[model samples]
Target: MTDPDTAATDAHLLETLANLRWNRFHTIVVLLFGLGWALDAFEVTLIGNVLGALRQHFHLGSNAMSFILAAWFAGLMLGASGFGILSDRYGRRRVFLASLVLYGVATLATAFAPDLAALMVLRLIAGIGVGAEYAAINAAIAELVPSRSRGRASAIVLNFWPVGSFVAALLAWLVLSALPADLGWRVVFALGGAIALSAAWFRRHLPESPRWLIEAGRREDARVIIGRIAAGLTDATTLAPAPVVQRVRREVNGLRVLLRHYPGRLALGAVLDFAEASGYYGLFAFLPIVVLPALHLPPARLPLFYLAGSVGALIGGFAAASLLDRIGRGVTVAGFYLATALALIGFAAITGMGAGAIMLGFALVNLLATGSWIAAYPMFAELFPTSLRATGIGASVAVGRIGAALSPFLVGYVGARSMPAALVMLAGFWALGAVAVLVWRRRGGIEARGLALEQLAVEPARYV
Candidate 1:
């Protein structure tokens, strides 16, 4: 058992961390970890942008191409579940770094795929890397960042999703327009691989989460890491501190922990992800491709519209980042969902008002709906203990991938018949997600705004 003095000291350690000024190390963490999602967006967005080209090159129809999306999501679910457990059991730095390498190599190899089967296989491999990143990066940032700033820090980290998408759009537009059709798509994949590879080196300097180390009973090690990060603080002069008596629990299987012990969180995460993924993958990401057919827009000018939509995501993401700490998770999440649903309804309302109206609707949905992605990760990161953090988040993301995998097909089919109905269906997704979050909160989910992970960890213990 922890004595009062040691408990106070441990609390001081967290307080000291929470009070540290944002500096070079924090910037490095953001850039390195942020790149994980950026590369994922880049790769996935590239697939979306280049789908027409792939269809032409491989003689695939829309249905077959959709399976490619499904395959990627399948790999994502597998990697998120598998790697989440691995990272929790092994170590964050190793699992996340290796996931990046795996993504890079797979993406680079995708450039050389000789046939459709080979290409699909390569995409699945790349998706695993992307999928693993979601769990690893979120867990690391939540544990490492100061408690007071965890919301903004994590928000900034995840906001890279749009940046990645925008970069992909830019590359695809420039490359596909400038180079030979066959070679341009290959270059885009190569570009993603190279960026991911380059980012891995910088990750080496990142420290293990002090919280995780402490949970594992490595008190001295955790203390040293905290000392190093807080080196400039007036009191952290010691390389080693006296060991604190901590309550080190046996490692539980993370899956069992979520399924049996903290079932509400598991249910909340699954439902939240399912709704967000359905709308995001079904409509937002897939919208640009469908607009030409659904709204009678010119195919040649779609890139400009797509760029505008991507920019909206960035705007909304940053806005959410700023508000997350202020509004608290429950309000922010519930509000975003309700607003996103309304935006989708408005989008459906303008189905035949000409291309301009449709475009505007798309932009609004892009902006408001992005909150789902922006808020989801930070909230998931906050929900579990250090021991179960990665697993819980990974399982959440895995559930998300399942929803994402089916959404494109569902959206494609529905939109082809009636754009209005499709938009409303997407709205329904948002409502479902919002309801899940609100219900979960009522049933014992903590709001987790500015609290430290240590503080948040205590809440679920009561119910679990």
Candidate 2:
């Protein structure tokens, strides 16, 4: 070959290698993060699915079980807030690893709970771990991915929640109901503990986010980790090093810093998150009761209802993942919430009208609303810069978790009075969430994917 032709070919080969490396890096991050997310989903959603068993085991009623679930979410709210601040201050690496251990130990402890009080305490601790882990992992993913692909990547990783929840539902059906009471729930708790080990394994694969590293003024360390990550992919060998990142160190304050500066973002994050939590958790946490009566199934058959909803959630997650990249984040989230609100209202009407409608509407609402919003985590994380990414997201999640924690209590309270009233209340919450998300998009930018990671790395004081 001519010398000029040889040079062109070599350049093309290097370019192809670079593209491959980038894709591999993206895929590995998503899969590792997704695995952790799945475990989180399993623990969080398991409460709803297993409520029947717990109620029967404790010789309690639905209202009491709702209280138990609420306690878990309350703990989640506190955990997310506290751990989010700690993660940002100490580093995602330490916070992430610690949360895994905390939740795992808590879950194991749950298996040995002798009474409702013991169960509630263990679940609260487990909830804290689950809540904190979500903030840490989501922040980690937000920092790791490039801006252009952030929405899609976030959607994909977030989809694992349904995957884990569905798997847990299936296992609860196969294992919990069939086994003796003590053994059954204990096994499920053991599973939750076992699954948490994935966090440790997952952290091994993840290096500190380059964005976080840059913000911390560890450019050399960031560069070395990036090189190792690059080498992990079978694309480029002896690749050009990533550019050195220089970031300013800023005085770190807690929520006060958020209140003083970027109040707009904080308000936006909190309102939007609160709405989502209310809508998502309100319906999801009550899935068993919603479906059990309508399906006309025996107590033994109730799990099938959960299993179906879980499938819907899983499918919805995958569908959300598929469209997140193509559709704008604002449009996707608003559209889902809007549709969900309408569908839920319709569901209440239909179910109130008759039995057949109840069965159908219950399935549709669960599938669409819960599944669609799984993609929102990335968009939420993107709303703030790196310095407060965890804090912002964590605080929002904490607020939302409060809503979630309350949802079951709200449902049980209303259900005792009237089922139709409960459904109407849920529809209202969904509408509220839909409105909050729409307003957020109108005020903020339309395309959250365009947000640069470096911008997130900007100190809180200088954020623009």
Clashes (backbone N, CA, C under 3 Å), per candidate, total 0, 2
Worst 10 residues of 2 by lDDT: 239-248
Candidate 1 Cα lDDT to native: 0.78
Per-residue lDDT of model 2, residues 209-311, tens digit only: 6556555645456555556655664222232332223211242465676777766567656765776677777776555555554444444455566667677
lDDT of candidate 1 at residue 32, scale 0 to 100 = 71
Local error of candidate 2 at residue 233 (angstroms): 5.1
lDDT of 1 by residue, 278-299 (tens): 8887775455445665554433
Q: In order, what lDDT does every prediction score?
A: 0.78, 0.70
